[model samples]
Target: MSSPEHDHVATDLLAALAMGDDPAELGLDADARDHLASCPSCTDEVAALRETLELIAAGGGTTLTPPPPSVWEAVKAEIDRPAGAPAAAPAPVTSLASRRRGVPTWLATVAATVALAAGVGLGAWVVQPDEKDDATPQAQVLGEAPLASLDAAAEDRGAAVVRRADDHLVLHVEASDLGGPDGTREVWLINVDGKRMVSLGLLPVGEAGDFDFPERLLDQGYRIVDISFEPDDGNPVHSGTSLARGEIA
Candidate 1:
């Protein structure tokens, strides 16, 4: 709260705490340690978090990936084709002159498309990053296991772990022989009621990132979480394959 630099320090400390690591050993220089000692809120948060992570580690190691906030409430959206819709309603092919009667000239449309392409190119050029930023992937990683697990999971198949916080859950997942792009992106969230499946973003991918669940969703009474590789091209249905799953005993 004091300074933007301190706030960045706080976030780094919190991330270390969330990962169940000793912040002192996380390459934090002297200034951060001094800042952490004086910051009571962060200290209290770290203390409580470490206890919960310890308990999670005490449980069986082999576990399933937990569901994210969007997993519950409803399944993936489906496009309902009309019950008796025709298989193919092909558009009538027409010559350029016939289409010219309907709207602006082809030259105008080409100019517009060229303008759009130039705009996109300029946007990308403006956002180019330095080496560190370039090294960081822009994609979201669904699980929160430490980087060590990620390095190991690269070669090992069927290794996934799930951990529970006081009001949220974290998943660590990895696999090799999974499935399709869209279907594989889908995952199943199995609770006592039934299955509230979810998509784990992508499969066989890891960067040791973490995801947080909504407190309200945890109160809804769903416990176990499982994920699968689902393709993202279209269909929003579960892949019916469980890459990894976990639940408390």
Candidate 2:
């Protein structure tokens, strides 16, 4: 059995790997590699995280595009604005594209991947008009899974769970081109036996959302991440029409 120290190292290694860091460059010693080779849970976690990262990176093309100067100027203006002021009207399409370009492609992709994996929006880092002090909490990534399309028509999906400082379990989900016109998409946590299940919440189409749940549910083995299409029938059960599914490591 691995000691607590080794397990901590393993977790750090997995997080680094998820961020697209080179394991060797991260100073993964021989002992750490050996532990990873022997621990099935750790191995599976690493595989899932790597797959998710690859999917995110693949979605972004190889070339890097720069944003226009106006985009930076607007962002700077917003940041420089007095606290408690109302946010200006939404920027134009060209400005939005410029804002996206302003961020380094790799950095933006990594942030989006992490945020999506953590059930947060890509705008987490964006400065808002809020005047008060804002602090970001540190979270420990527990595990992840790649959502597989149930059918050829389904789009790509991924999910990860993180343990917040307060010990809450937060699920981060990402979906692409997976929305349906019939109804909104809902998230579910199901057991391996497929008998017990719990609804986390609804997910925005083609975007990411972080849903929090009591950690005890996970302790009871509800680790399957599922997305389903639910119509406006006012029902509170699984739709039986699974769009994407993945098993958490």
Candidate 3:
């Protein structure tokens, strides 16, 4: 029996060859090539992978219907069957061509597994509603706010953007030059009233972050984006150390 590593090398080389790649350009060692030439099992596996890739490529160019849920259930049952038990005959898959050459049982199983996965993915894509269907509205940019440093000497800067899709609203925050004391930095959605603020989450320095809040918050006048320097003193209240502030328009 071939070592697992050798099997993997041969499988990769065979896959490349099957995809119209030249054997010489694949950098396959002479010994591995010789083994592939001499080993019947390796030969069968390479052929099976080639056949599988061809079928998948053919599928990409056409609108093929996906296999039914029952087909997936049958595949799952076979995979879950206990070891040493006889495998019941597999159900016929619709698009698979009849075998051109005899392959070992293991090779057939591998090919079937590949085909089943491809079929499942294709089926999922087919069932997805088209984006242009209009029943699902595309996200719209509600507005943006440019963050400015509260201190005249600080270089802190960022922008806040609000977008809405259907009933959901998301806040996107990006920051730069946000230098502050050695404490955690957090995002916040402060109500225009200035007394009530909700902590969105932590913001790592020099990274962009997104926050999700209810549409009702915008309706309730929570349109300010504030990033504050906070000390880890087990307090949830805003620390009053604003690094940058902006009001969403």
Look at candidate 3 and give me any clashing residue pairs. Answer: none
Q: Is candidate 1 or candidate 2 better by lDDT?
A: 2
Per-residue alpha-carbon lDDT of candidate 3 for residues 8-46, written as tens digits (9 for 90 to 100): 333334445555665545655565566667766556656
Query: Candidate 2 — which residues are off by over 4 angstroms?
Result: 1-137, 152-155, 179-181
Worst 10 residues of 2 by lDDT: 91-100
Off by over 4 Å in 1: 1-168, 174-188, 207-209
What clash count goes with each model?
19, 2, 0
Q: What is the C-alpha lDDT of each candidate?
A: 0.40, 0.62, 0.66
lDDT tens readout by residue for model 2, 1-249: 344234423333464555666655666666665666686655665566555456556753332232345444555565566777754652111111221222345444443333223322222233223332445546777788788778775446665555654758888887665645678799999988889999999987655888999888878999899989899899998989887888888
* Candidate 1: residue 55 Cα off by (Å): 33
Model 1, span 48-127: residue lDDT tens: 44443454566554222323323211112111334554323221111122212222233223222222222211111111
Rank order (by lDDT, best first): 3, 2, 1
Q: Which of the numbered candidates is closest to the native, going by highest lDDT?
A: 3
C-alpha TM-scores of all predictions: 0.28, 0.43, 0.45
lDDT of 2 at 10: 34
Best by TM-score: 3
Q: Total backbone clashes of model 3? A: 0
